[model samples]
Target: MKRLLLERALYPLLGLAVIVVAWQLYTQLYAVSRIVLPSPSDIALASVRHFALLLAQTWPTLGATVLGFVIALVLGIPLAVCVANSRVLNLTLYPILVATQSVPKVAIAPIVLVWFGFGMESKLAIAFLVAFFPIVVDTATGLRSTPPGLLELARSLRASPWQVFSKVQMPAALPFVFSGAKVAITLAVIGAVIGEFVGSVDGLGNLLLAANSQLESPLAWAALIWLSALGIVLFAAVALVERLVVPWGHSGR
Candidate 1:
């Protein structure tokens, strides 16, 4: 078990090291200009030089991602339960939900901005919109698939509806919920960045746009790196929560 886990951790680091080595070599061999693609070392320097500014910008983006993710969870799971339990709701609401996803988020980002204005509200709304669907779909599937044997056993015991749901259905659905959360967390980050790109005075996305406009390639790369790190961190956090919540399961480590 120790060896397996060690390999799991080491493999990704090995892959990253190979990529960095290749990237450094390519830049050196081609003598890549700083304007086009800055080296990893250049980006590291930029990150250090502007650490304070990056931290300042990171807060808003992180806030939006978190708020939006929470909203998705609050709204998605209960709706999933309702849809899973009620054929009428599933029929009426599912099509509309699917239809909304057909619209490109970027196209409607302007409309959301119009509705919520250029503030944190707009970012939160967009993040919620982006992260909501996966949870609803995954949780609904899980709820519907609760084992028939368990349901029969509970019913034979005269289990109350709430007892059955709280004890069996919800626990059974956790793996699925966590699956969606992993996906939604990444989407939340993207959604926040989109909100920042469309209109915002803060966030890594805004900082990125500003850097590119000024031809600050190193700064832009640094922001990009930070954004990628943010996504990975959020994803890992969700996975960790899953391990805590569903300790018996794999947690997809």
Candidate 2:
């Protein structure tokens, strides 16, 4: 366990530390303007100085991201099941999903803002839009990828469709569902930031933009770091859940 922790966590932290030290040295030796690039120390100081404000602004983004991700899972899994099970639905809905996905989220943000306003609703909507795709695609793939022999055996045993789905298919799909969830959660953060960038009065994204516009580079960088941290935390959460629910899948790795 200790070795695993060192390999997975400590090494990454050490690498990051090295990068930060190198960055600080470069800035000091060359006198890089703080406006163009704030040193790590400056960003750290800014984070500490405005920690309360940053924490306050983080809630909205976090709420939108988490809620949107949950919504994606709630809707996407069932949708994937329907599409995977029904050839007609797959033929009908899959193309529409693809078409909508092709349209840039940035382009749709303004319309979402108009519909949902500059509130958390807009952010949530945008997050849902971004996170929904991967969940559906990956889950459907998993369902289809279920070993034919297992499915045939279940059928031969006279297992009901629901029984086969709930027992055989869902278990096989767990890894894929979690994979999509990991991707969706990170994209949820991006989507929330996009909504905030387009129009919002709160969130870390707004804070970052305000700091940047006011030439408070350190504060902006701090917010950027916080955003990265938030994404990492969320991704880690999904991964932890995956490990718990699908232990056999990750045992070798």
Candidate 3:
């Protein structure tokens, strides 16, 4: 395990080092204007100088992401359960859900901003909309995909509905729920960026856009890197939670 992890870390680090070296060489050799293409060192210096300001602005976006993800989880799981339990609701709502996803989220961002305003609420709404579908689909499928034998056994034992759901269905659904959450984390960041792009005057997205307008390409790249890191960190967090909660889920696979 240690060797594998070290190997994984080494390759990425080495790749980054090579890219940075090449970027530095290219900028110097070609005499590229710093405005046009800042070297990796330029980004590093910018990151250091602006770290405090960046973190402060980052907090609101992170908060919105968390709030949206939590809301998605709370509402999604229950709605998924309802759909799983009722064939009529499932048949009706499933197509609606699919149709909703077919609409481009970016095109709807302005409407959501108008409806919810430019505050954190709008950003959260965007994140929620982006994240909601995956959670609902994954959880509903997990619940419905319960093994026939186990469900039959539960029925044979005259298990109460609540008991069967809690004891059998929920456990089976956890891995899928986590899978959806993993996808949702990345989407949550994207949604926040989109919200910022459309309505908000803050967040990494806004910062990036401002940097672009000012032709501060290095700062824009820095913000992009930060955003990527945030998404990766959120995704890793969900994976860690999954490892803790459902270690056996992928034992064979």
Candidate 4:
């Protein structure tokens, strides 16, 4: 366990070290233009200088991501339960959901843009689309495949349908629900970025676009860095929630 923990920490530390070394080497070795690839130090300075602007843009993107993810949870969990309960609904809707995902979000972006305009609504729609499927599929599987013995015991006890579901199905399904939530949170960030990329006046994605237009490579890199950080934060938040809510998961860990 100590070795495993050390090994996990080692990779990220080594990776960051390697990246910094390579960046320093590139800046010194090749006559790479700063315009094309700014030094890490340069990017760091730029980030500090423009911190307020970055923060201002970030809040909106964060808000949209949260809104979309919440919407996904509200919509997807119930839908999963519905499908889990009914073979007919599962047969009819499962394929369609799969198909919906297979279609590229970029293709849907314009339609969403037209319907919801270039505001947070379009971004929220995109985030919801990206997040919806995983939660539904994972939760459905979890709900339907609860431990056979427990389910049998519930049936034997002549428990009401609501009681069985509330006590057994949902609790058993929490782990799977959280698994999907982890995926959804990451996708939510990506979706918000995509929505901003397509057309938004604000967001880290917009910051990236604008920086690209001006050929401000360092600022763009800063936004990319922040975007990655945001993803990490959101993913960690879900993981923390999972650890708190799923006692079995914590005990297993």
- The candidate that wins on lDDT is 2
Q: Which ten contiguous residues of candidate 4 have the minimum total lDDT?
A: 244-253
- lDDT tens per residue, model 4, 7-110: 99999999998999899789868967877898888788879988998888899889989899999999999999999999999999989998888899888998
Q: What is the TM-score of each candidate against the true structure?
A: 0.96, 0.97, 0.95, 0.95
Given candidate 2, what's the lDDT at residue 185? 100
lDDT of 3 by residue, 1-253 (tens): 8999899999999998898899999998998988888888888888888898678778888888878888999999999999999989999999999999999999999999999998888889999999898999999999999988999999999999999999999999889999999999889899988999998878888888998899988888788889899899999999999999998788653
What overall lDDT goes with each candidate model? 0.93, 0.96, 0.90, 0.91
Give the poorly placed runs of model 1, Cα more than 4 Å off. 251-253
**Runs in model 2 with CA error above 4 Å?**
251-253
Ranking by lDDT: 2, 1, 4, 3
Which has the higher TM-score value, candidate number 2 or candidate number 4? 2
Q: What is the lDDT of residue 10 in candidate 2?
A: 85
- Give the Å error, residue 200, model 3: 1.0
- Relative to the true structure, candidate 2 reaches a TM of 0.97
lDDT of 2 by residue, 71-121 (tens): 999999999999999999999999999998999999999999999998999
In candidate 1, position 61 carries an lDDT of 98
For TM-score, the strongest prediction is 2
The deviation in Å at residue 18 for candidate 2 is 1.4
